[model samples]
Target: MNKIFETPLYPYTHHPDEDAETPVRHKTIVVGAGPVGLAVAIDLAQQGVPVVVLDENDKVSFGSRAICFSKRTLEIADRLGIGQKLVDRGVVWNLGKVFKGDEKVYEFNLLPEQGHKRPAFINLQQYYFEDDLVARVRELQEQGAPIELRGGCKVTEIDDCGDYVALEIETPDDTYDIEAEWLIACDGAGSPIRSMMGLDFVGRVFEDNFLIADVIMHADFPTERWFWFDPPFNPGQSALLHKQPDGVWRIDLQLGWDIDKAEEKKPENVIPRLKQMLGEDAKFELEWVSIYTFQCRRMEKFRHGRVLFAGDAAHQVSPFGARGANSGIQDAENLAWKLALVLEDKAPDSLLDSYSDERVHGADENILNSTRSTDFITPKSQISRTFRDAALALAGKAEFARPLVNSGRLSVPCAYDGSTLNGPDTDALPARTRVGAPAVDTPLGQGWLLDRLGGRFQLLTVDADAPDRLDVGGIEVERVAVSAAGNETLRERYLGDAASGVYLLRPDQHVAARWTSFDETAVRAAVAKATGRDK
Candidate 1:
């Protein structure tokens, strides 16, 4: 019924079933239509599961909420078929600079190798990214993919029934009840769904506040990220400058806890700080500015019965590392395929339990890392502040201290090692070792590395002819033989040598297990445990 689906690219053909009247229920109901929520919906629809995404807003939010998309997220977007669009629209940034009082402390060039399918990071406005994703969702809807978007529909309550979930939604026009076998809450930090479930989101909220301003500017600053600690213009405070699309830039100015929250947001107070940072000669117009408090927190459990949490609903981290949204999208990617498999009966419902365990682990790790970065950037006590200043001064001179200055705190893909669903790396095979997410690189085939490995549970064996020696049933195995002398760059990046034999990749592209001799029983059992079917 949405008018956006009338375009030529949007193909909608409703399949009339004789049993269509049986109360409409989707296999999955996703709350919140933000990037993370949409990513989950798209992945589920691609795997042939019906999904419905509900949001209170009719369109993308206006603010520049999240801007940096990491390589792992780009891989997820590539799997969803929209990576090229993102690449074309975003500004690829491979370097960063850190400064203390107009002196360059350190710098980093993030250009990894040329063989990577994507860049290290892309800077794009969060609104633009969400808009493009929404367009893609509309296109998929036209193709009769069982994905539906209901805008202006607010979920008022949820009743979890262990096996399923029932939601009461209030739309602008009517109030209705929807049922789904599973529910995913991608709602923002003040999640109504998480609250309705009586979950605890415990964490610390920093006393300092930040004034976030998006502005169109003409400046000589480099495209790389710029951070200034206690610059003369903003003494006793921190500032950041990031180049965004369309000649605009994002600026965050730290406002100490002493400032009146009500009065600090006025343009009169904000523009002067901008003028001081940019100098009087610089010309610019402020687009938007607001004051926000930062928090580092995570839900104790990511999943409660049949309802799961994703994005801000599950965890909230200080925006220092830009890990808040990035981690959320990763959470969605990790949960989607498992939910799809459960719906298709390819895996048991117990597989859903792993969603909470794995993501919560990652969220806890992210919170700790981001919190540490925040403390380093914005020291609260006098002793801590003195230590931070001394550290920066030392980093400015010491070559070995440059890494600390560059702050290698970007979000990395998380593994499922300590979870109940994942098993230990046993010493059964000579050269096969299965651990962590699969490292992506240009392989023998012309297709993408992730493309070759994503979609279903894959078993990459060193020898294709050794099927008789492997008992990998209920899983798709792709046998790829690596030369004893591996690709030089890949060897240096992954295993120190190319002598490693085979790798078993999960649906999410994480390595499940590996073996050198193509031992059928070991590979089969590894796949079973990775897929939560070993029992």
Candidate 2:
């Protein structure tokens, strides 16, 4: 248990606005200073939008929550200027092993290919992640970024006034009012803001619970995700293990719905279970312990008037796939650019509707996968369990059954396949970089391709003729020209069999459109379609 988790990073302080004649309005206000909130705030501030963040607490998360950071999330973090710090301080792993009743069934490599800079996943405690984000905020503030974080400031009431959102915030010593031209709610799963607005999630809540134990120990377990179904120690149940930074290991034990959660979390009962799995003599100290239920749900709509929701406030999923935090980060990234554009008058307010549409699609994708993983992990009926066991047994001997074995489908980037923002596409280029999909990373010059994209709308040309820059309506699209002549990986990823390719990328690095060759008229229309102008 690091002291950083309890230390106040952003203690409450008096502000001039508290004594103002009226509510001091800001261009943007973010509620809840968690990872997603901080991420979006940083994004907006970097884009020169003055944003304020309000949080009731002043410290990082208390436990080893959200231990897995996906590769796509790391790329987004790179744009936020915090990617390398997370990678440097996290456990990098790409291999996963599954077992059935003490026998290893099969293994999988998440990222088998080369040329990508980031690993498939990194295991770091959520507290460490938040601490680094707060540090990044401080660094950005030092560099004169227009971002403010107010701790111990709990937003008690939210009033959506069509044009702006009025908020009532409570501090330790006083209460005050403020207004925001646009509001972003990144609160937790049990979001008070969402409750205040009388909104609710609509999805499944599985009747099962999982115990998470963050144990500090010196173990020889390889740095890979290991999952066991009906292991000896936890008979008739499933378990998961993974290495984290600072000699910590995260263990998850599935407990059927009937058990008492509080008793299961007790060390008196938890230690014996650990001893059974670790041979009675293992030396370990419990750093954190908690029980969680599987819930795959999301709000009907993420946007309401001028207030928008991101992260757990908008959607939630089972922990098995590591989609919770990762998807939330994606939500933040998606909304930040759109909100920024709308506020700057570069795009219409209808552009924000695409945020809701795209993220709801993402949430539904995560929910579907998470629900399937939960069902497979915890079969409701005996026949379902029998089928799962059969799949597990066959996975040990046959390659085809391996795909049926669901040790929890690991998190992957959600491609907005049919988003309205997606522009024209050609079958000539690679499908991996197709319209609405994220731009695949490849080696470029001495660096990586993603490092150059960096949260900007750009024209990616692979040996294709395009202008140095183009002003589509009011938005600037810079040209990034790279020849695919000597770059096989780049050609394979971007050009494929096509002689040349041109791509229009959104600020989030998603392919808005692609063409075999650049056409000025078509490019302008694509930009209009992407910005919600055409609609």
Per-residue alpha-carbon lDDT of candidate 1 for residues 1-535, written as tens digits (9 for 90 to 100): 1222222321222222112444356688899888999999998988888898888777676667798888888888888778888888898888888888888888876765677788888988877778778888877888888898777678898898777797877765556676789999999999999888888788988888989988887767778988888888899888888998877799998888778876887888888988998887778887767888878999888878888899999999887777987899889888998998787776888888888888888998898888888888778789988888888888878977665652427777676666665544534433223475444655544555566668776656442335522335544665544442445644544344334546677777877766544566777777778768877
Against the true structure, candidate 1 reaches a TM-score of: 0.91
Candidate 2: where is the Cα deviation over 4 Å?
A: none
The residue pairs that clash in candidate 1, if any, are 11-142, 470-520
> Which lDDT value does model 1 have at 513?
66
Give per-model TM-scores: 0.91, 0.99
Q: Where is model 2 poorest over a 10-residue stretch in terms of lDDT?
A: 454-463
